[model samples]
Target: MNQRRLFIASCVALIATAMSFAIRGDIMGQVQQELSLTDVQVGWILGAAFWGFGLSILFGGPLCDLLGMGTIMRLAAAGHIVGALLTIVSTNFTVFFLSTVVVGIANGLVEAAINPLIATIYAGNKTAKLTTLHAWFPGGIVIGGVLAFLMTQVGFGWKAKVLTLLVPSVIYFVMFMGQRFPATEREAAGVPFGDMFKELARPLFVLVWFCMILTAGTELGAGSWIPTIFNRVTQSATQAGILQVVWINMVMYLMRQFGHNVSHKIAPTGLIAVSALVAAVGLYLFSHATTVTAAFLWAGVFAVGIAFWWPTMLGITSERFPRSGALGLAVIGATGSFATALSGPVMGWISETHGTAQVLPIWSGLPLLLIVIFGAIYMVDKGKGGYKAEKIA
Candidate 1:
């Protein structure tokens, strides 16, 4: 696929991720109020979609590799449209929550399918390329949050706000339908699934998976819980809406655009390690925030810290280890997706029963854990490889 087509398709895919999370921030509070939910119940609704996405991702990856990225993209676009309609039609918590899950599954399936697609399409420039591709996600979040602001003003309401996301779903489906899928390295080499999966499980592969779990867990856990945390800390329901996710994604969006460039000049490993500490400080500042402006700034700072972690790390796995193909994407994604799925409710329960202050440990501990683990991986890779592997393809 040409870069133009790839960029269009990636925008569609990233929009789904942005939309999934867009709901998590502002609209979630609206839905909860309309539906009359408890904190635990809200967590379930928020977490349910991720759970659907995480559980089904293992299947989505292989299917994409088997059926094709264009097919997966079209199917997932249809899902977002359906999910939007379901959310609009919902009359009860069951229906509304179920709709969120549908959206989550669609988003999860798309992530599983496309991350590998980009890795294959761009091939040699996986780290920089993936960072650029993932940048669309946070950028889309900024769009979604801003759209939500406008939608509410024109009497669009929450349901209308959700259904509006269908516009891109349609456009994405059309683009992908006319496009050609880039061939996976395994397919070009005619390797079978059994062989590809077996090779993906090697010791170094395990280290990559470890890094994915920690990074994903920390990032998603922090992003997902930020609003609830803000609401509790400052007791301002209004500001927390676009502020939390919007701020987080905005900083994330910007860094993702520049991360690879910065990494090239500095070093991706050193940048990641330092970024983790920045994130920890941001989270601490966020937890202690007394003013809304301070909170938003701190949130953005934290997002910047987490900004490059996912794309850079996933780029490492996919580019540095393309021999694993779609299965490799599946395994690494599984670890983090599952962690995010679990963290949602866990954070909710803590915030609900133990109070939001308890979230400090969860959010703070997550990045610290990632910094430690990825730092270890950095040491191990440096010691063993005795060389910085610059070649991506």
Candidate 2:
């Protein structure tokens, strides 16, 4: 296998995933206004992406073993292309919702394939490499955010913004066309399928699984709302709101590039604990911002807080539950998505019933709770000779 080529391809696929998130969020207010939908209805449409991602990754995990990572990658590309087109042509709520789900599924498939792919290819440096690979997530967000802002400034419609996603989607799909993919780390180690499932029941895995829900919700739920929330909070131009999303992601991209050094000094669990505390404060401060300057300042804190949450969560799980293979990764990823999906509508309701400013404060509680859970986990790991990856044997 050409590891360099595959890794590059994986990064591009992730770029597609991240772009969808940024663009979709940037255009959400336009969609709501154009469709004449209520806040609750808009929330459901937004949540579709997460729930769809949750379901696909849930099934795609074991299927990766059965089908092959290459095949899963192909399907992910197709989903991105199809979903993007569907979204572009969507005229009603049902079509838009289903199209978003397709996009979500595509995003989920990218994780199902690439998470294990990175773990397999860079087995010696799983956490750091995965962190570096995921830096493109924010990288893609920056790309998409900037594009959306520019397009909006140029008087482009929301459909034009959505169409831009197809560029990376096609690029990744063509790149993966003839490339060879390695077996998952578990498969290469000759771990049995049943043994992989057995890892799911382990106490550590179970605890992390539960924590995944909160961490994901804390990171993505608030992120998904940033554009709309900031728009409402500052009563500023739409570009300002999108720029806030771009700014936070820019901080995230830079931080994740240096994530390996941090991983060496702090266990993944410890990192998560600190991230939770910072995120809570950042998010709370952001919820109260009355000016674009204040919004950007607080968003920088929120960005650093969430930068490591997703990739590190996956990294620790892959390390500690080597036997669980892709399933363990998928389970935790799916949990995060589903939790975010559930929270989306609730966030909308909170915004509608209370105010847009109220949403982040409510979500800030998620990470506060995470600080307690991950802090305890960090202490336990420290007692056990610090955090270490398990061997498959």
| RMSD in Å for model 1 | 2.8
lDDT of 2 at 116: 91
- lDDT measured at residue 85 in model 1 versus the true structure, 0 to 100: 90
- RMSD (Å) of each candidate, 1 decimal: 2.8, 2.4
Model 1, which residues run further than 4 Å from truth? 29-44, 349-355, 384-393
Model 1's alpha-carbon lDDT is 0.75
On residues 1-393, what C-alpha lDDT tens digit does candidate 2 reach at each position? Answer: 989889999999999999998899889889988978788788787767777888999899988899999999999999999999999888888899989989999999998889999999988788888898899999998999899989988899999999999999999999998888888989988999999889999988888898988887778778878887877767775547767777888999999987656887888889999988999999999888877788889999999999988889999999999999999988988898887777677888998998777788888998888889989988888898988898888
- Structural similarity to truth (TM-score) of each candidate: 0.89, 0.91
For candidate 2, list the clashing residue pairs, or say none.
none
